[model samples]
Target chain A: MTDGLWVYLAASPLLWLAGTLVVWIAASSVAKFRPGNPFLNPIMLTIAAIAGILCATGIDYGTYFEGAQFIHFLLGPATVALGIPLYEKLSLVKSNLVPMLSALVVGCLAAVGSTVFLSELFGFAPAIVASLAPKSTTAAVAMAISSGLKGDPALTAAVVVFTGICGAVVVTPMMNAMRIKDFSARRTCVPWDWHRACLLRGSRRRIVFRNSYGTECNSNISCCTSVSVSQLDSEHLHVDAERRQAHKRDQGAGCRLSQWKSEPGKHRARTRLDAINGQQPRRRPYRRGPVD
Target chain B: MLNGLAILFTFQLAGEIVAYLLGGWVPGPVVGMAMIAVALTLTRSTSFLNPAHEGTVSTSKTILANLGILFVPAGVGIIQHLDLIRDRGFALLAVVVLSTVATLTLTVWTFILVKRLSGGYGND
Candidate 1:
């Protein structure tokens, strides 16, 4: 009787769609417990869990995709929605218009060119190279580009996630090593969403950074560097010390670090971070003090 | 929310149309993104007509905030390509990591150079 019921439900597209959403919600909640840990990525966890279930059940990917495609269809509208953040940051974009545009063009070339060149050097198949080419872009856009290039969209998505995690994990160490004193410049290294994934792990540090320097954080780039710096402090003491030394050279950041320690949460850093990421903060448990 | 979604879809539809005309070299949604940016810029003067108001921004934000999950379905296709991954996994990872680091470094340096040429320094 249970097998019969399972067969009936499995045939319906709603089953997997509903299952994916349920799993996602659960994973996201769990991820909140250890936001600083990169391995605790909600999407990664959800994908693994869903993939594991499918493998265990001996279900084909094609069958699971029938239901999951509903979620996939949303990528188009979401891509269009990206314009909102671009528009909101228009003023800042305008100020650094020349630099931003030039950097964007150069960055796009470097990302694709380096990927292709390196993939060729490694003697990867053409399809794999195409898939890797667009991995630096967000998954939605990258998958689209990959498919257009006659590459595997699935492989592209995996690569994109891998690329994002790599970028997130390396941003602090890299920026510190480069000695990029400009907070705004440092923030430009990683894409916004991936950086947010990295930064979200340490809410309390973000709150401290925000409360101590909220007004100055009016610009998105400013907030990102300070928040990430504060977040990475616990994970990398030596790097944190180097950053503090760099901050000491800048009067504002030097004092703010000291002030951040004593300052209680006057403003909601959650909301600020959300606003920066072009999303409102969801209602979740508020854990005060350091997350680490 | 509905209205905002309509606007987003309309832009995406337009993008799809454009991509079709361009022989699909560029993805439709990217074209749609560009269209939205252009429309936003053109309508900057008119607040009522502007799409960057609260509703659209909120809708987009909500969508983008959870954007990572949207790709899970596609990534699961990895099951079919397990052999490929098993063979090329290490090499693929090295390429991605090196390229990303290169991209970040190149982008940041270019940005700094341009910023310095245009002005003295960015606001700290």
Candidate 2:
């Protein structure tokens, strides 16, 4: 009777949803304690924990996925929802159109070219090479591209996740060490969501300030700005703190533009920082006015 | 929430139609994303699909917040390829890591160089 019950429970779709949510919540809670360690990446932890459970229970992946498809279906709408952020940042994107387009083309080509060349050099099968070709793109898009090229969608999905984690772990520290602080370049190269999640979750300080050259300094960590970039001095740091506080206070009110108007220098710095970070400073509703 | 979803699906459906007509050279969702992005740009001055609207923003955030969950099913699919991975795990790891770093570095540097050559930071 118990074995029969176990089989029925394992086959239910609710089992997968409940298991995934419980594991993810537990992993995220654990991650909070470490605060800034990439190894504790919540997604990685949750995947391991659940995979271990599935293996131990001898439940096949197909059964689990059958239940999990409910969550998976949301990915389509979520992907389409990416337009929200892209829409929010339309003006910034429009202003930098030329450079942004060029960077995107170059980045896409480099991602595919390097993966293919290295996979070939390493003697990976052609299918594996094809899967790796679109590894840097979002998983849904990568899977489609991989299928079109005759690669395994499952392998492509796995590689895409691996690539994201690798980029999250390696790139930030490498860029910091090299002192490559150009905001435009960073914005152009790094996918927006990946960069935000990695930087925000990994650092205790919530707000990051970019100096003119693009080096990011944690502004709120010490109740004062910690200026790590060589070009910025204490004076700029002081101004950055004031501006950040003002911006935060007004953030809820959606009056970022008004605050910006109050201090042109602060506004310029804030805009520059937002651009560099690939974030948009929150703004109030659009109003038809001569001053807007 | 429903309205936001409606807008999303509508655009996705339109993209599918276009892609189908064009023989699927590009993926439908991607084309849909571009179409939505273009629509947003055109409608920025109006409130038609203002992303800042409370309902839309909150709904979009909820969907994106759990974005990792969407990839879980696919990641679990890795179980099927365990044999291939076991045989070439080390080489696969090395290539993925090296190629990712190389691509990121090259992309960032190339963008910076191009931006500088184009007279820096454009009009913004």
Candidate 3:
């Protein structure tokens, strides 16, 4: 009777789908209390738990994917959804266009060139090296690029996730150790890089930034502003502290442009920062008139 | 929500067509992203009054907030490459780590250099 039940459940499409969701929820719940703990990453946990269960139960990845593909299909839509945040950051992007584009050119070349060069130095096969080439971008885009290059999309996706995790773990210490003082300089790559999500979550726990370059935006975190500074010098930290206080005062309405105007305290912070710079705050894309 | 989803899907479909016409040089979703971004920028003046715009932004936020989960299915594809992973896991890890470091350092350095040359502090 139990054996029959096992076979029946395994055959149902809902089984692994439900299983993946449950495992993910549990992993997220466990990781919730310890903010910034990369080791307890819910995605990593869910993938590991499900992969382990499948292995022990003798279910092949193909079988498991049949049910899980429903979730996977959302990646395409999520990619489209990235436009909203990209739109939101248009003003900032405009102001930083030169720096942004220059960084993109240098970053893309460094990301792909370094990966390919190092992979070859490590004696990886051409296909495998190609798979690793686009690991710095979003998993979906990287997978597509990998396929175009005649590499394995699966390998590319896996490497992308791995590279993201590694980037997340290393970025904070590496940046801090180098004493990167400018908040904007540190996140210049955020608009073009998804690897910073881990850095975002690990370091800036308050506001989640949604800016990216040419890939689907990761939305596992908050989506208000990507400009949250992490461990910056005292001056920027003071501005951030004021912003945080303003956010709290507004009952967590966040730093949305709409909210930024209504919250006098946030407005005051921005005005003060602008005064210090001896210039006016850059015009917001959504603002209707001159500063009040 | 449904209206917003429709808009997103429409853009994605358009993106697919664009990508196909371009011989897949760019991914469909990315092309779709650029299209929506352009649309949003074009409509920014009236975005405050457009309910559909609000709906799209909120809908996209909700989806992106759970983006990590969407990656699971593909990340699990590592199962298929277990042999390669097993054979060169350390080498692969080293390469990823080193390359990532190199990329981040170079990108940040370049941005700072350019920003300074442009006479801005990157304060914003």
Give the C-alpha miss distance for residue A100 in model 3, angstroms.
Answer: 1.1
Model 2: clashing residue pairs? A181-A214, A181-A215
The 10 consecutive residues of candidate 2 chain A with the worst lDDT sum are A218-227
- lDDT of each residue in A1-292, candidate 3, tens digit only: 9999999989887998898889888987776667566666677788888878887888988888888999988887787777765665566667776766677678777878888899999999999988898887777667767888899887887777777777767776777777776666666544333433452353223133322222322111111112211211112222234554664566433344345546555665555445333343444455443211
Pairs that collide in candidate 3 are A191-A212, A191-A213, A192-A213, A209-A226, A219-B64, A219-B65, A220-B65
For model 1 the TM-score comes to 0.78
DockQ of 2: 0.46
Tell me the TM-score of each prediction against the true structure. 0.78, 0.76, 0.78
lDDT by residue for model 2 (A22-132), tens: 887887778768766656666667777877888888888899888878877776666566666555445555555565566666666677777789889999889888877
| Residue ranges of candidate 2 with Cα displaced over 4 Å | A196-292, B44-54, B121-124
The candidate with the higher TM-score, 2 or 3, is: 3
**Backbone clash count, each prediction separately:** 2, 2, 7
For B26-45, candidate 3 gives per-residue lDDT tens digits of 77877787778778766655
| Model with the higher TM-score, candidate 1 or 2 | 1
Which DockQ values do the candidates obtain, in the order shown? Answer: 0.57, 0.46, 0.53
Candidate 3 at residue A63, lDDT? 87
Clashing pairs in 1: A35-A201, A36-A201
True contacts kept of each: 0.78, 0.62, 0.79
